[model samples]
Target: MATYDLIVVGAGALGAFHAYHAAKAGQRVLLLEKDQYPIGATVRNFGQVVPSGLAGRWFEYGRRSLEIYRDIQSQTDLTVRANGTVYIASDSDEWVLANELYDRYQAIGYPCELLSKLQCLTKYPLLQPDYVVGGLFFPDELSVEPEQMIHRLIAFAQKKYGVDYRPGSVVVDCQSNYGGAILTLANKQRFQAGRVLICSGHEVRLLFPEQLADAGLVVSKLQMLLVEPVAGVTLPGNMLTGLTIRRYESFQECPSYASIPKPEHLAELQKWGIHILFKQAIDGSFIVGDSHEYADATKAEDLGFHTQDYINQLMLTEARRIVTFPLEVRKTWAGFYSQTKAEIFEYDVDENIRIITGIGGKGMSSGAGYAEASIREMGL
Candidate 1:
């Protein structure tokens, strides 16, 4: 059989982006997925591409991803909409962080708008006036329907870049040689590639369990809800609240962040890691979420499979406090993603085999840009 230039395992956002970049660079690529479609963290996310929430290299990656996403949208429909992102501060302390973050972005020459309480109310009528003081807005950010975007992206890559995409093909084995790597499917069929990149999200036991067990990866379980479409309620873009302003990594970069006094009243929210955010779907329903719960990758089961009603209640209680529109939870589910203390997990099994996963919530924000850099670094 002919050896391809690259083989990407797992056609999720991370893997698909890596394949996209390599194929775009004129490399022969093979993309494989065990499932009929990507249904992991890639599709089960808020789909908010808010680089404003990131810091350091990831911030840079997110910025680049914005361009890549916009470029792709220009080519075909990826469900990408440039509506923007806003962080509405509820109190003086959170407002302080918002202003500081705005100033930080200004210094870096990134475009951002500082909105007055009146401007915020005018722009987003659903926000509760009492709950919002002032806001920091990034007009360049985007929102996507995760399921639609990933599927469309795969199709676009296949048509435009000539990528060989095989879905529902389970990879049973991976072995590396000096020339490249070999992958065996569950049906006993095999394929060869000059290099193999595993972007398998949180499922690590299939290939290199030993390397991953000690890779310092932790699986984060996030709970989210979908509110039934409230008629005539238009909450534009990504509506992030005081809790999000206080929790996002970008706010931590501000000089005043370290000293901002925590609100004792929100102790329970802190305990549950709840951050209230709202995004309107094309059908007019509001997508609301989410709370973070974690366990070591090897013990991801500890995070549990059942949805905790208490967590959903906590999120709804907080969301109702921020928006005026009625929130009748229509659906709720849990999303799993892997994360480490570092930005992302990268391991090399040999010269031709590499493992990249554990991007956390930054996958949609930074995956394209990071994968581009990764492909270039590998000289693919």
Candidate 2:
């Protein structure tokens, strides 16, 4: 029998981050994951640490993460790209919204710039003027190779802080007994830990249904695509469109939303079809997304990838407005993340066991910050 100070289940972004901080804090930590490789939402979507789409405290946290990511390439073996971000508005109304967000972000000391349509076109000719009116730019945003990020974090934890990793070790049960917790794995192996932090995403309920029963936590499926960049065209950094402003916290937190006509905005929402976020990869390819669909009863097969007719048409229609190159679609995929009706899903399953989940879809942006907070809360 082996013992540790903390046992973190799930090796997705959240779990990996928690394990990293715990190990750095000198606690004997064990991280368990059912898959040999991380194959969840953590690595499925764009590896963007978006500072512009987060709320008050989360926005600050994202800024800090962006700073960490910028320095991480030198501090560790992680692959980080600080290419910044751009938000394009397709019409005058949306331009008003973009200016409103830019002004508010500036007031709060967030690094951003409001760009005119001509300025955007002159800087990046791939953008078709018909699809864009103006653009907002964030000079501090960044992107990472999601798979590379996880692997580097794992390596950093192991080589630098001595964290124990147990991939393919599925946690079947966890319970608090006496002063500690007993964790039973799928192979009938049992381990003890002074504290247990469940960073499991959508599967959190499968392990502790009774505890999280009241939290209205559920899984959301998102579809994303990767496209080959048109030759000679380069996106300065990451990119978002007016649609992103409407869906993400970037617009909702701004005064623009308050002044926008509700009926007109709602109509625009339907017209855009889905949120459009674009980031150029180190390979010169662009990763774009995404569509949101939720249901109480989710089928494994229902998570299949298909060219969403509406989303595909809308993205291509909009991408041309922002980029100069002729884009060609490459690959498409779907991802799932836990979404809670509340701010976050944090509760003690028992005295020594705590379950923390539900970061909505902003895990990549806030994963590290949340992990640091979770470890501190556990007194590790």
C-alpha RMSD for every candidate: 0.8, 2.4
Name the candidate that leads on TM-score: 1
TM-score of 2: 0.92
lDDT of each: 0.92, 0.78
**Residues 1-380 of candidate 1: C-alpha lDDT, one tens digit per residue:** 65899999999999999999999999999999999999899999899999999999999999999999999999999999999999999999998998888888999988999999999999998888889899999999999998799999999999999999999989989998777999999999899999999999999798899999989999999999999998889877898999998899999888999998888889898898899999999899889999999999999999998899999999998898889999998999999999989878899999989999999999999999999999999998
Stretches > 4 Å off in candidate 2: 262-273, 297-310
TM-score (all chains, Cα) for each model: 0.99, 0.92
Where is model 1 poorest over a 10-residue stretch in terms of lDDT? 230-239
lDDT of 2 by residue, 1-380 (tens): 79999999988888988998899889999998888978888988788888788887777767777766666577785777777888888777678888988888888798889888798888667777777788888888887887678978887788888888989998889988875999999889999999998887777445886666556776677777789866676776777887787667768876667676544634633553467778778788888777776644223345444546666656666556555676688877778887777767888877798888877787899878767777887889
Cα lDDT, model 1, residue 367: 92
Model 2 backbone overlap count: 8
Worst 10 residues of 2 by lDDT: 295-304
